[model samples]
Each structure stands twice: as C-alpha cells, then as structure tokens.
Target: MPDLALDIAFAWATLLLFGGGLLLLRARDAMHRILALDVLVSIVVAQLTILSYSRDVSYYIDAALALALLSFTATLVVARYVTRGRPF
Candidate 1:
C-alpha cells in the first residue's frame, strides 16, 4: 500500500513539474522564465528526496543539493545576461 502510494505521488509530481516547465517555456519575459525554471528545479529536488525514501541511498540528496546550487548560479547568470545584454 505504501509502495503504491509513493508511486502515485511520484507520478503526480512528475506531471506537475512537466506542466510547470511548459508554462515557463511559454513565458514572455526572461525573468518569469527564470523563476519558472527555479520552480521546476525545486520540483525535481522534491522528487529526488522522495526517491531517497525508497532507495536506501543518500546520494540523490547530495546530487539534489548540487543541482540547487547550480540552478541558483544559472538563474543569476541568465538574469545578468538579460539585464546587461552580455555574459560578462
């Protein structure tokens, strides 16, 4: 029962993340897109955390942490590029 519950939860989360990502892709403003990207990344992290509960491994958490940091940096860089008109 618990296993089935987890599977359902994962499926729901995946659908939500994909939907949010598509919305982000359709956003007109770069900033809005970036924010949406952040939301998607967070959803991915949440999914990974849930996976950790069943996998008996903490590696996913570490990767999720790394992804959080990388996503933050990516958002900052894209914002800067959009604002400054250059990578710099």
Candidate 2:
C-alpha cells in the first residue's frame, strides 16, 4: 500500500514536471518564460526530494541543493540581463 502511494506521487510529480517544461517552451514573453523556468526548476527539486525520501539516499538531497543554487544564480543572471542588458 505504501509503495503504491509512492508510485502515484511520483507519477503526479512526473506529470507536473512535463507540464512545466511545456509551459516554459510555450511562453511568449521573456518574463513569462523566466517564471516558467523557475517552476520547472522547482518541480525538479521536488522530484529529487521525493526520490531521496523513497530511496533513503542523502546524495539526492545534496544534488537537489546544488541544482537549487544553480537555478537561483541563473535566475539572478537572467534577471540582470533582462533589466540592464548585461548579466555580468
């Protein structure tokens, strides 16, 4: 029963990730695309956290953290570029 629940949760997460990816690709405006990308990154982090919980692995958490940091930095760079025309 527990395993079945986990499977269902994972399935939902996968669907959300797919949807977010599609949204990111379909966005017409730069701001909308940035928001969609953030959503996609968030979904990836959630999936990683769920995997870590189900598999009893710590490395997944570490990987998720690293991904989050990268996402944050990228977002900042992009925001800067969008506002000021330069990322660095």
Candidate 3:
C-alpha cells in the first residue's frame, strides 16, 4: 500500500540525511561543503514532505516550503561568497 511505500521512502530519506551530514563533514573544499549542505537540506525537505503526507498535517508542508526557500537563498549567498569572497 501507499503507507508502506511512504515508510520505505522515509527510511531512505533518513539514511540519506545521515550520509549528507557525513559528506558535509568530510568535504575539504568550500564548494564541496556548500554542495553537501544543499543536499542535506533537500533531503530534509523530502522527509518533511513525507511526514506531512503520513501525518495529515498541513503545517509540515508549510514548514518544508519555508525551509526550501531559505535553503535556496542561503545556498545562493554562500555560493557567491565562496567564489567571489563576498556575499551580497
């Protein structure tokens, strides 16, 4: 059923989240670290979406939206800073 599928997806997302964290920690360069962080945020967003569906809560989706927007803006700023030595 769909519930079982969602559970599987949630487990995968959790594993990915931990893997992303490891990648972020192991990255030796600024760009690599930035990319890892973005990946982590994306995984978190996916997990949040799964939670929203499974729990039937609207707020989780809203929070996920806000998080995604913030992550995107932050990634843009950080990427600029890493390449240009300044964020603006």
lDDT of 2 by residue, 1-88 (tens): 8778878888998999899889988999888898899888988898898899899999999999999999999999998899899999
Cα lDDT for residue 87, model 1? 67
Q: All predictions: root-mean-square deviation over Cα?
A: 2.0, 1.3, 0.7
User: Model 2: which residue pairs collide?
Assistant: none
2 against 3, candidate with superior TM-score: 3
The positional error of residue 13 in candidate 2, measured at the CA in angstroms, is 1.1
Segments of candidate 3 deviating more than 4 angstroms: none
Model 2 misplaced regions, further than 4 Å: none
Using TM-score as the yardstick, the better of models 1 and 2 is 2
The most accurate candidate by lDDT is: 3
Question: Please, what is the whole-model Cα lDDT of each candidate in the order they appear?
Answer: 0.90, 0.90, 0.95
Residue 85, model 2: Cα distance from true site in angstroms: 0.9
Q: Which stretches of candidate 1 lie over 4 Å from their true place?
A: 1-5, 86-88
Question: Candidate 1, 42: how far from true, in Å?
Answer: 0.7
